[model samples]
Target: MTIFEATGAAGEQNIWGIVLPFVLMFAVFYFLLIRPQQKKSKQRTAMLNQIKKGDKITTIGGLHGTVVELTDDTVVIRVNDTTKMTFERSAVNTIVSSAPAVAADK
Candidate 1:
């Protein structure tokens, strides 16, 4: 009778042992993968909202230009003295330099 009861208790503990590892794995994934991605997305949205005219920006496709105009969905980028291209706001990867950086550095 003692041996049978001990075996049943051990099986109950084994159920928790299996579930604990899956719960820990999910926690690790949330911290390592999901959390950082959410943070980066928020930061990118903030950057896009803060964009203004004359900011030097680079696109995901490697186009670098100065922002000339901003609209709700598009930005006009002057790539050269006389050439300009309009790109979607989401196409901008980062602002390479703000107006302050241009004036203060040189």
Candidate 2:
């Protein structure tokens, strides 16, 4: 085959090779980064909404406590005997235990 014809064929292949890598990168980012992040956010929101008094929880800052009072946008958590702290509902990280936790000293 002529050199001109060979060059033309290679040019077309190069364009697709360049584009394919970018497409694959985007797919990887979506599945590995974006999709899992979205799922985690949804789960966190659902957990916050389901919180109730006496449920044991931990804050995003790692403080462990029990839910004492809940409001529209905030929660009152008893961190220890006579130690209560208020935090935004969104600040709760996870439910340490789903069962109602009774203070042993009570």
Report every candidate's CA lDDT: 0.95, 0.93
List of clashing residue pairs for candidate 1: none
TM-score of 1: 0.81
The C-alpha local distance difference test score for the whole of candidate 1 amounts to 0.95
RMSD of each: 4.7, 6.0
Kindly list the per-residue Cα lDDT of model 1 for residues 1-106, writing each as its tens digit: 6999999999999999999999999999999999999999999999999899989999999999999999999999999999999999999999998875445565
Q: Model 1: runs farther than 4 Å from truth? A: 1-11, 100-106
Q: Write one digit per residue (lDDT tens) for candidate 2, span 1-106.
A: 9999999999999999999999999999999999999999898888889999988999999999998899999999999999999999999999888764556985
TM-score of each: 0.81, 0.72
**Model 2, residue pairs in steric clash:** none
